[model samples]
Target: MIITKSREEIELMRESALVVSRTLGMLASEIKPGVTTLQLDKLAEEYIREQGAIPGFLGLYDFPNTLCMSPNAQVVHGIPNSTPLQEGDIISIDCGAIKEGFYGDHAYTFPIGEISEETSKLLKVTKESLYVGIEQLRVGNRVGDVGYAIQKYCEDHGYGVVRELVGHGLGKTMHEDPEMPNYGQRGRGKKFVEGMVVAIEPMINQGTKRIKQLKDGWTILTADNKPSAHFEHDVAIIDGKPELLSTFKYIYDALGVTSTEEDKFRSKAYD
Candidate 1:
């Protein structure tokens, strides 16, 4: 069953979401060539603790790190390691946190430095598809509506939408009801309602949609050994539309990029 959050509960979740958002913002400047994912993980842990919230991913499923640091061909759940990132590579950092009895989870894929034009376009299209998916998360829309939007947007650009993994509802628990897939048919699955919040993420690949897991049993990679991109946002239905609980403003600020893309999704109250 889908759990609808009260306005008070939604605000609590927003605080949790912002905690993870701020953690990512702090790490944004630190992501580059020669930096190890393990190092980023350590920084995230310290920052989250200082905020008075526990790392949501740590020990939740026996996962050892504070972040899921997936790089290059890796899709998600890649354990942080000593491997130093190289220029032209990209890494997706998925983070979660719990504060005031609520959970926030989201992800962002970052380029190490200068990347290939092909890879750059992949990231661009994947991120665009994320917003397209988010636009479908409005009242009266079904889960598939959101998935179809994402899939169509990416597939039109020759990208593969990951089938095995999907987004999920969020609240007191990290994962809740109504699995949000990246690809599906419209008018199918559960219909969205007001006060419902979910983490809508699109994991798109540059090659085939098939994926494989490494021996570590955590890392997922594209079957053809091609690169993939993942972008996520925490969204809630407020006043009959989708409101963003997570923001990329911090990331953009850290990276020195200026964008007003989120303006349409925010209200004066959140400002």
Candidate 2:
């Protein structure tokens, strides 16, 4: 069943979501060549604890890390390791936090040093597809609407939309009802209602949509071994519209990048 959060519950969720947003922002400056994903994971664990929130990913599924650090061809669920990131490589950091009986989950893909123009375009299109999906998360819309928007946006650019991994509803648990896929037909699936909150993520591959899992039983990668990008956001329906509970502004601030892309989804107080 789809769980609808009360307004107060949504506010509590926003707080938890910001904790993760801030954690990603702090790591944004530390993501550079020679830095290991394991090191970044340690930093995230400490930071999340300092915020008075527990690391949502750690110990949840017998996972040993605080963050899901997938790099280059790895799609998602990549375990953090001692391997140092190199120039032109991109890493997707998916994080979660538990606070006040609620959970917040979000993710962002970062580039190490400078990347190829082709990879840069891939990142751009993937992120754009994320917002396109978010725009479909409104009252009376269905889960497939969001998926269709994301798939159409990325496929038109010749990118492959991952079929296996899908986004999910977020609340007290990391994963909840309403599986939000990246590819589907419009007007299908469960209908979205007011007070519903979910994590809408798009995992787009640069090659074929097929994927494979490594021996670790955690890491997922593109079957063709090509690069992929993942972006996510926590959103809630309020007043019959989608409101962002998580913001990438903190990450953008640390990287010295300015954007008003989120302005349309936020309230005046959030600006």
Candidate 3:
């Protein structure tokens, strides 16, 4: 069943989401060539605890690290290691936090320094698809509506949408009901209702949609060994519209980048 959140509970979730947003922002400056994923993971754990929130991904599902540090061809769930990131490399950092008894989860793909033109375009399109999917999370829209929006947006750009791993409803527990796929037909899944909150993420591959798993039983990779980009956001339905509980403003601020992409989804000024 889809568990909904009250207005008060939604505010609590917003707090949890901001915890993660701030954590990502703090890591933005640290992500550079020669930095190991494990080092970044350690920093995230300490920072989350300093915020009085537990690392949501740590010890959950026996996962060993605070972040799912997937780089280059790795899609998601890539375990953090001692491998130092190189210039032109892109890493997807999926993070989570638990605060006020609620969970906040999201991911962002970052370029180590400078990346190829092709890889840059992949990241740009995948992130754009995330907002396109978010726009479909409305009062009367179905789950498939969101998926179709994401899938169509990426596919039109000749990108492959991953099928196995998907976005999910977020609340007390990490994962919840109503699996949010990136590919589906409109009006074919559960109907979205008010007070519902979910993590809508798009995992788009630069090659075929097929994927493979690593021997570690955690990492997922593209079948063709091509790069994949993942972007996510925590959203809730309020007043019959989708409201962003998480903001990229912190990350943008840290990077000295500016964009109004999230303005339309926000109800008020993001502070």
Candidate 4:
């Protein structure tokens, strides 16, 4: 069953989402070599609490950390550890926060320091694939449309689209109905409607799509042990189009990067 939000409730969700967006922005400048994922995780917890919101991922499924700190070949759900990131390496930080009784979840893959040309391209393409997927999350479209868009963009770049972990609807509960896969056929699965919100994430691997779980029962890594990238955005349907509830603007600003790629998806009223 789909959970539709009223205009007022959607505004509340936006507030919740911006809290997460701001948290990631604050963490952007602090990410680099010699910093452990555990350290970053700790900072995230404190910051979210300071905002009067609870860490959504903490203890939700017995997960110990506030962020899923997956690095290099790791796909998602990687537990934070003492391992210090090295230059040329990349890590995906998947974060979730609950505020005003709503949950906001999204992710971004960051380069540890200066990355290689190939790895940088992988990150670039994977992120691009994410927007491609979000563009499909409009009214008159189905879940498969979103998946197919992501898969087509990533596979065409010789990347492997992860099949196991898919995106999901968000609201009071962390994981809601309508699983949003990264690969599927058009016209398949549930049709999207206004007021419906979902997290559309694309987990693209540099090698085969196969994955495995760590002994810790949390981290998921690519089977080929090759580098992978994951990017996500929280989207909602409003006025029959996809509106972004979360933005990478803060991250971009903190890193001094410039891009107008996400402009089209952002809400005009909020602008």
Candidate 5:
């Protein structure tokens, strides 16, 4: 069953979500060539604890990391290691946190130093597809609406939308009802309603959509060995519209970038 949140519950969720956003922002400046993902994981664990929130991913499902650090062809669930990131490599950092018994999950793919023009375009289109999907997350819209939007947007640009992994409803737990896939037919699946909060993420691959699992039983990678990009945001339905519970502002601020893309989804100015 889909668990809807009360206003008070939503507020608590927002606080938890912001803690994750702030953590990602703090790590933004630290992501560079020669930096090990294991090192970044340590930083994230310490920071999440400092904010009075527990690291949501640590020991969850017997997994042993604070963040899912996937680089290059890897799609998601990549474990952190001592391997130092190199120039031109892109890494996706998926984070989660728990505060006031609520869970906040967010993710972003970052480029190390500079990347190839081809990879750059893939990143740009993948992120744009994320917003396209988000635009469909309104009251009464079915889950397929969001997935269809994301699929069409990315496929039009000749990108592959990952099929195996999907986003999920989040509140009090990491995964909940209503699996949000990146590709689907319109007017299908569960109908969205007010007070429903979910993590909408688009994991698009540069080549074939087929994926394979590593022997470690954790990391997932593109079948064709092509690069993939993942972007995510937590959202809630309120007053018949979709409202963002997560923001990339912290990441943008740290990188000295500017964007008003999130203004449309926000009900009020971010404090």
Candidate 6:
């Protein structure tokens, strides 16, 4: 069953979501060449604990780390390791936090250093597809609307939309009702309503949509050995509108990048 939150509860959800948002922002400046993803994972674990929240990914599924560090051809669920990320490599860092009995989940694909133009465009298009998906989260739209938006936006740009991994409704638990896929037909699936909150993520690959899992039983990668990008945000339907509980402004701030792309999705004018 779908677990909907009241306006009051949604506010609480925002608090949980922001904890994760701030965590990602903090790591944004620290992500660079020669930095091991395991080191970043340690930093995230400590910070989340300092904020009085637990690492949502840790111990939840017997996962050893707080972050899913997928780099280059890896898509999602990549375990953090001691590997030193070098120039031109992009790592998708997926994070989660449990605060006040609620969970917040968000992700961003970060560059290890100065990357090539082709990979940079892949990152840009994937991030754009994310917002396009979120734009479909408004009240009165179906899950398929969000999926279609993401699929159309990325496929037109020659990216492959991952078929296996998907976004999901989030609240007290990490995964909830309403599986949000990146590819689907319009007007199909569940109808979105007020008080519903979900993570709208697009995992787009630079090659074929097929994926494979490693022997570790956690990491997932593109079967064609091509780079993939993943971006996500936690959102809630507030006052009959879609409101973003998580923001990438901090990430942009750390990377010294400026953007007005999120302006339209901000419920209030962003300062």
List TM-scores for all candidates, in order: 0.98, 0.99, 0.99, 0.98, 0.99, 0.97
lDDT of each: 0.93, 0.95, 0.95, 0.92, 0.95, 0.91
Name the better of 3 and 6 by lDDT.
3
Off by over 4 Å in 2: 268-271
- lDDT by residue (1-271, candidate 5, tens digit) is 9999998898899999999999999999999999999999999999999999999999999889999999999999999999999999999999999999999999999999999999999999999998999999999899999999999999999999998899999999999999999999999999999999999999999999999999999999999999999999999998878899999999999999999989999875555
Candidate 4 all-Cα RMSD? 1.2
How many steric overlaps does candidate 2 have? 0
Candidate 2 lowest-lDDT run of ten = 262-271
- lDDT: worst 10-residue window of model 1: 262-271
Alpha-carbon RMSD of each model: 1.0, 0.9, 0.7, 1.2, 0.7, 1.2
Mark the regions of model 5 whose C-alpha exceeds 4 Å error after superposition.
Answer: none
Compare candidates 1 and 3 on TM-score and give the better one: 3
The reply for model 6, stretches above 4 Å from the true place, is 268-271
TM-score of 5: 0.99
**Model 5 deviation from the true structure expressed as Cα RMSD, one decimal place:** 0.7
Please give the lDDT score for candidate 1: 0.93
Per residue, candidate 6 scores C-alpha lDDT tens digits across 1-271 of 7899998888778878878888898999998889999999999999999989999999778988899999999999999999999988999999999999999999999988898899999999999999889888877889899999999999999989999899999999999999999999899899999899999889999989999999999999999999999999999987667788888888888889988887777774422
lDDT of 3 by residue, 33-101 (tens): 999999999999999999999999999999999999999999999999999999999999999999999
lDDT of model 4 at position 20: 85
Per model, how many backbone clashes are there? 0, 0, 0, 0, 0, 0
